[model samples]
Structures are given as structure tokens and as C-alpha cells.
Target: MSQLLDVIVAEDNIVQSAYLARLIENLGYRALTVEDGKAALDLVQDSGAQILISDYQMPYLNGVELTQAIRDLDLDHYVHVILITGMDEDEIRSNALAAGADDFLPKGHNPTALKARLRAATRLVQHSKQLAEQHRILKEANDRINDDLNAAANAQRQLLPDIHTEVLGTQIASAFVPSAVVSGDMFGCFPLTDTLIGFYAVDVSGHGIHASLLSVAIGHLITPDFFARVVLKGQEQPAPANLARDLNARFSRSENDDYFTMFCGVLNSQTGRLDFCQAAYPSPVYIGPHGNAQTVGDGGFPIGMFPDLTYENDHMTFDKGGLLVLCSDAAHEAENTQNQAFGSERLEKVIKTSHRIETDGIPEKIVEALSVWRDRIPLEDDLTVVAFRRT
Candidate 1:
């Protein structure tokens, strides 16, 4: 950035050295002279000089040797070396270049040629320093972005419910595996009153920061507190179907193009009765005291698709000791090494075989099964699972 300010000259002959140093000073640069190659290296090392001009055939250490040694040192600046030799320019050209000289000069006190070479070296130094500064600025920006993403992921964790817990005689367990720093899939159930519990499992359409942000916004929008605030003034409580319709209306008014699929439900804590609506989500598997697991509910329109989409509610009895399983598409869509999908049939098979495990182990078993199928962790999409058993 600043002009090539400091230069060091190594010449064993005092007469030629003084003449050359005078010429450099006339070019508006500070120049210092050393009588040998060893002194040149030391001066350049300590002074942080960016330009070097040296004479060949010096005693103890030659000019070529000095050039190589200076280049090898790990310094904060880049050095440009010029080799001045008594031999013909063609004769010493190969060896001088091989030893790392950037340009070569013929031996003598020619003021015009000296001025031209030093001028070129000044431009080279300016360009190199500019590039180094740009690299430093870009690295700082990347580090700041990574720090912000990590902070967002930590805040998103608060939207999730406790992992393995039981309340109102119901055991609930969940597992969340995000492929990126944040996740687009969110699921949790909250109590609406002493006699009722509402739950939802949702997946936004796209992946990454925008999708993750919307999922968190949607989580708060549907919570019992927010839902209670938006419902009709006279209505003390709302059914699951009416709640789904309200979400459709609110999201339709939003300017975002992204949409989502969800399963919204309510349970009578005392009677094991579930009233739920499935909006373009997976048909949750019902595991009761039966011999085989049965899938429940049919698909309907997804949320935010239509302003007047009337949602349908289905009823099922989550009898005591019965379990319900819900998951995002990432589970079945995961691909094995052979490129085959671990589809719905495989997921159903795992539920039937492992449903008898302790209440807290159900979600863990599903995650393990998925890991084995994929042969590793970190699936390509956000993976989420929620399982609850009525006791």
C-alpha cells in the first residue's frame, strides 16, 4: 500500500556499493548497504525490507545463496530479489533465477536501468500487499456468520419440549437430528387444561435458515397461549379441527411462499380419547395391545395451501397401554448405500417389532433403526420423531 520504502544492498566492493546506494536514495526510497551476503540476510530479516538488490561473487556467501536463504525465512512480508552479476546477463541468468531472484541486473552503475528495475519491484510489492489485505477481510466475515448461526441453533432448542418425560399418565419421548446448524422440523405437545392436551408435528417445505425461522414462528403461533389469544371471543376452548383452520387462515395472509404439513390433535387426559386432523402428513402408526401395528388417519390439504380449506377431524381411542408414533419425511426418505429408500414398510416393521420396549425407549429405537439403515449419522434432511403412550 505504501511505496516500496526500504531496500537492502549486498555488495562486497565498497566503491560500487556506495554508488548504487546513492542512486536508490535519489529515487525517493531509503537504502542501506552491507559488505557481505550474511549481513544482507540479517538486515533484511530484522528490518522487514520488501526489496533486495545484491551483487554476485561475494566472499563467504554468494549473492545467489543469500537470495535463496532470505526467501526461505517465514516473514510477514514478501521480498523481491534482484541479482547483479559481473558476468554476461545470459551466462548468470539460469543460476540466478534457480536460486529465486525475481529479476536480474547487469553489473555496473547504470542509473537508468537501476531506476526502471526498482520501479517494477515497487508495483509488485503494492499488488501483493493489496491481495493479502482482501484475504484477511473475507476470513473475518465468514467467522462472524458461523457465530451467528450457532447462536440461532441454541435459541431454537428452547422451542422443543423435554425429551423423555411423563405427564397426565402419558409417556412422551422425542428425538431431533438436524442436518445443518438449525432444523426445519419441529414437534411438541402442550397441555391446554387439566383435562386436555394438544400436540402437533410439522415440517416446513424448504431447508436452511429461512425454513428454520418459520418453524419457530409457527411453533409459537400454535401454542396453547397463542391459540387461546386468537380464537373467537366467546369460545373458551377450540377443537383441534377449528385450530387447524385458524392456522390455515393466518398463514395464508403471510407473505412467505413457504408452506408446511402437520398433524394436529387433542387428547382427553382421563379417557384416552384422541381427536385429531392430518394435513398432508404421514399417517401415524397406532401401536396398541394388538398383535400388529395399524396406521391411522388419511391425508388432506396441507396448511396455508388454501384460504377456505375445510379440515376434517378423525377420532381414535388411545386406550391404556397404546402408543402413537409420528415422524417427518426424513425417516422413510433416508437412502442406504445401495440407493434404496428405507420406506414406509420398513418403518412399520420396526414399530411392530420394537413396540414392546419400555415407554422411554421407543423414540430411541426408531433413531437407531434409521442409523443402521443409513450406515451413519446426519441424514441429508432434518429428522424428527415423537412418540407417546397413554398409560
Candidate 2:
């Protein structure tokens, strides 16, 4: 029911202090009255007054001095100071305002004018306090949201595999850069045996946390137990072809209509036998040791697009020192500022001209080429690439 602020009235004259106190109380505010400027300053500091009404001439400290003392407290509380003055000099009024006084009340104002000034001051303080409170709440909420995002990003980073693994005489290297805090593109490798390695690169239909979560689900499914069942064919030994089919069937039955394009492969390091399959994904290029590049095709409709579609297994026997490069649509579909795509043809040219695939520079080259082609145009999709060499 109280709409008025906590006000401090500082006046050496008892009559003026009493008069202002009556006005303040009538206006529904609690006024703390002090006879001298020193006492007023002390009370304001102790009570945290939001408004100050002070006589211009007072013993010990004048209104200007009192205002300066209050400001020196340096508290967060906003104290709106009103100087009461009989002086008609413009210079005096300017000095009062420059000393941190918010307004001036002429000492001999009519009751109506005094009431009007107090009413206006009440509104101003209320509006300012409301704005300050809103700012505090907004800042707190923003901090909380930022903290949550950082926590989620750290968790996602932990989900990624450590980029080092060795099987037989084979060494693998991989890298991932999410377009956002998370991404839809995923890559992983698992050692199926001392001489065999299972690996996959997948790009789900969308991006962001939802797509990243789906990739996590796929990661969980790539375990030894799940792949064992997926690779199983009849009572006989499960082949790579059977693994591709089973994975597609499981994905079709369990997933939604939005398809995920992927290249899954199993490699036998001892014999240079690599059996792999693709589902509506880009064909992987085999870069032979002789510096020849050929696109290996194992095409099928992307899993989850068709329930009963069959995936074909493609086999490649690479010579020692050959390399394989697999990538997502982002690699080929990258566009320039003129809206021209950096198509698959450009990719092949880069690979061919380079003679030898520079182990460390492959990813950097792909990204650098794409960036140069973009020419400052914004990308609409995530770019991903993986390359491995058989030494």
C-alpha cells in the first residue's frame, strides 16, 4: 500500500525539517529527519535512503557537501538528492545540480507546487528502480544460460574418441570440427581383432544437439556386441556384406523417416583386404600408392529412407602405402560467393595434382580450399572428411 520511497530530510532549521517531514509522511513516505547535514549524511548511510531532501544552508555541511558525502559512500543504492534553496542565482542552482542533486525545491513554494514536485520525484525513482531490478534479473538469467551451454559442450567433447589407435602395423588418424557446439557428422573406429578394424563415418539429416544425440546413439550401437550380431550370416562366419545389411535393417526399423548417410567398413591389415559398404553416402576414393585415384562405389538408398533396401558390399585390395579418403556432402557441395558449388570434380583434381596425399595437410587443404571457394559466403551445411593410408 506504500508507494513512496525511503527519504532523508537534512535541514538545520527545525521548522523546515518539520514541514518537509509532514509533507513526506502525507505523501506516504517514511522520512528520516536530521537537524544538521552531518547527522543527515550519517542517517542516510546507515538507513540506505533512496531519496534525499536537504536545505542548501546548514551547519557543519551544506546541501552540496552533504550530496558529495552521500556519493562518496559508493553504494549501489541510487540516492536522488533534492536541494531546498531560497537562493535565486542561476549559478547557485547550477552548483547544486553539479554536486549530484537530482532536483531543486524552492524554499517558499506553495503547498500545491511542493506536492507536485514530490509526486514527480516518486515516479522517477520508481521507474529507475524498476529498470535497475530488471537489468539485474536479466544479467543473472544470461549467466545461467551461458553456464549451461558450456557444460553441455564439455560433455559432448568427452563423447568423442581419442584420435589415436593402432591395429597390426596400421595407424589411424582422425579429426572432427563441429559447426556449432555440437554436430550431426560422426566418425569412429573400433578394433574387431588384432588384424581387423571396424570404422564408420555418418552424417545425419540435420544439425545441432538433436543430430549430435542421434550420432551418440549410433556410437553406442557400434560396439562389439552389436556389430557381432550385425556381421553374423547364417551359421557360417558373418561377412562384411551381411554386416552392412543388418545395420541397414536395424536402422530402418528403429529410426524415423529422415535418413542418415554413412560409409561403414572393416579392414584386414594382414592381407590388405578392405570390405566396405555405403548407404546413399558419398563414394570413398581410394588413392593408390602409384598416385592413382579411383572412386569406390557401394551405393544403396540411405538407411531409414527405405525399410527393405539392400546395401552392396564393395571390396578393395589396396597396395601398401595407398590411402583412402571418405567425406560428407559438405565437402563437395561447398559453394562460392557466386553460388557455384565446389563439386566432386574439383575435389578429384586437387587429389590428383597433389601427387602424394600429404598426411598432415589433407584436412587443412580440404578446409582451406573450401574456405577460399566460399569467398566469404556463409555455409549452410557441415563439412567432414576422413583419410587413412595403408603403409
Q: Highest lDDT: give the candidate number.
A: 1
Candidate 2 lDDT:
0.74
Which runs of model 1 end up more than 4 angstroms from their true locations? 1-4, 8-23, 31-120, 227-238, 337-339, 358-365, 368-377
> How does candidate 1 score on lDDT?
0.83
lDDT, candidate 1, residue 84? 91
- Candidate 2, residue 177: Cα displacement in angstroms equals 1.4
lDDT of 1 by residue, 1-391 (tens): 3454898988989998888999999998889899999999999988888899999878777888887888788677789999897656565767778878898777776889889999999989888888889888998998998899999888888888998877677888998888888988888787777877778888887778888988888877776776444432354434566767888888877776878888878787898888888888888898886645888888878888668898887878888888888988888898999989999999988887767888688788999999998887568888888888888
Model 2 deviation from native, Cα RMSD in Å: 5.9
Model 1 RMSD in Å is 4.2
